[model samples]
Target: MHNDLPIRKIIHVDMDAFYASVEQLDYPDLKGKPIAVGGSGARGVISAASYEARKFGVKSAMSGRLAEKLCPNLIFVKHRFERYKEISNKIRKIFLDYTDLVEPLSLDEAYLDVTKNKIGLPSATLIAQKIRDRIFSEVGLTASAGISINKFVAKIASDYNKPNGQKTVNPEDVLQFLEELDIRKFYGVGKVTAEKMYQKGIFSGKDLKSKSIEYLEDNFGKSGKQYYYIVRGIHNSEVRPNRIRKSLAAERTFSENLSSEIFMLDKLNQIAEEVSNRLNKSKVSGKTITLKIKYSDFTLQTRSKTLPFFINDKSIILENAKELLYQDSLKNSVRLLGISLSNLNTDKKLSEEPIDKEKKSVSVQLKFEF
Candidate 1:
């Protein structure tokens, strides 16, 4: 079944430094300091770091030891996913107040379909601003919002101005805004793919759109279609619902980037095992797998390959993940690492690569955040 096409009013909302910000809001003393949430122990990893810390080159998933070196005054605290999750629930409730079509990307971000709403606001831009205000007032956290006609543009607009900022990309402005966009900034353009694009001189949306779709497909494979429309301000993705998730993962952040054998491997094993348990509880099996890695400099990479057979075995999944992990050259100690399983038994695959407003069950992550 295809998602019904609608004249959607999509808004993407992302909290600023979710965990670290929340901690700061809770503890006034940590407000201006570079606070990295995790621990300072040798094995401790940062889950999130304040923007102040980011300036000092301290970031999420960095080792405490390394973070200390980068920012001598960096403060490390333990993660409280439960608190973040509770905050997420509050944010979800706020979105539902605007529309039932809310698609959550993480504990701190979501996409809202506000074509229809309880208050019935006439302007989506106003709606986006109102939501941002509500998040700050009620949740005590700053949020950025993007408002647009479709998901892709809206997602990009939200990040146009970050840290308690918001931008609205009217349909008329979509083309111009996209034209100057860096190909690397486009969602789903990971580190590896970005380097490849740069090598080909596909620096901005204009450069990317210059190449024929055929050439892009030949080079980027399945993701070429996404590259084609994103440059033109078109995205056929949907806002999926909260469902019985087939898989889940827990990643770690070191205070500093790490390339050591013991650090990354141990982290992967931890994430894979968590995913296994989530799958087991959901009683779902998947054939396709993905591994996400973020480097020290905040460049991200993902290596995903599909398997012919579906399995819920943890060992099998972890083993394959381990292989994918070591396959990449040790460029830097990874700051962030995560794993996911797709290709579900009851899978939804779109033949047409565009946003479908009819269905909210399945949607594309649309590769560009490589």
Candidate 2:
């Protein structure tokens, strides 16, 4: 633990294969079966897969054709978003009972700051267990939790013991825990970044910590500074209760690729209508309209036009999208199309200050319990 950092108890709760688990819970026949929640068409992408399906390498974002080849008996189910939201709300209510400082990452995961909880329990580990138990008893779903001094470590720890288990990293063990962690397992290090780190011989946290801040910044830009600090257990980001929506979008993958501009007009209109409906429901409009095109070869392209004023009407969105669609020649047949709005009316100015920007006078507690 750093002497100038603040120590706070953070718990990250992530549900186990939420959508697939929900499906199994609602239908007894689906339980213990290899199930995937998504369309089972030629162009369909799996949204979620059950643990049984995962054993056969069936995973979210995989194509239905490939999943079928991997698991012969894979069952595809449609999404029930409203039901998922209802159950998520119930789980959120349980979190609120313990602490108001809860930051939801998604319907299936959240980060809770329980340094001073409503129940007056000093142990965050116990609170996490009780919350998980309550969720299983009340909502009929299992959740995993990770308890630590900050959000960064807690988020990673939650995955250690998954599918109805929890892990707590005490403050004193934070450094060693991070040092022994794989670089690929670090939250922000994706496949490309991990390969880059591997090229530089930075395979673990200890290896990442061996680099100079100057070297990291020069090589990895802004993210390098974050890596340098997080590896040292100095992440000070607070759990935000009200996370703002950054953008609104609607997209669809077609059963067959559209080769001509004339064939895309109808699909564009439908997508625009969906985006407009979502915007109206959120009661917000945006100045930036973007068109996303995914070709049959899987390459993606985006075109944007920022308007002088915000608009959320389907006709206006379709108009801008059409112009952007014709802005460039198509390299290949289009398989997917999308419309998105950003620079929204709901957006507000927020701070981007780094944790080490200013020094703290009080030393953080090194012996803080999870």
* Each candidate's clash count: 33, 0
TM-score, structure 1 vs. true: 0.78
The weakest ten consecutive residues by lDDT in model 2 span 357-366
lDDT of each: 0.79, 0.91
Cα lDDT for residue 325, model 1? Answer: 81
Instruction: List model 1 lDDT by residue over 96-172, tens digit each.
Output: 98888888888998988777777878688888888989988998899999888778888888888998898887655
TM-score of each: 0.78, 0.91
**Pick by lDDT: which candidate is best?**
2
Candidate 2, residues 1-370: lDDT per residue as tens digits? 2465678899999999999999999998999999999949899999999999999999998889999999999999999999999999999999999999999999999999999999999999999999999999998999999999889999999999998999999887888898999999999999989999999999999999899888899989999988888888878788889978879999989989999999999999999999999999999999999999999988889999999999999999999999999999999999999999999998976533456633321234556556
Q: Which RMSD does model 1 reach against the true structure?
A: 7.0
Residue-level lDDT for 278 in candidate 1? 80
Which candidate leads in TM-score? Answer: 2
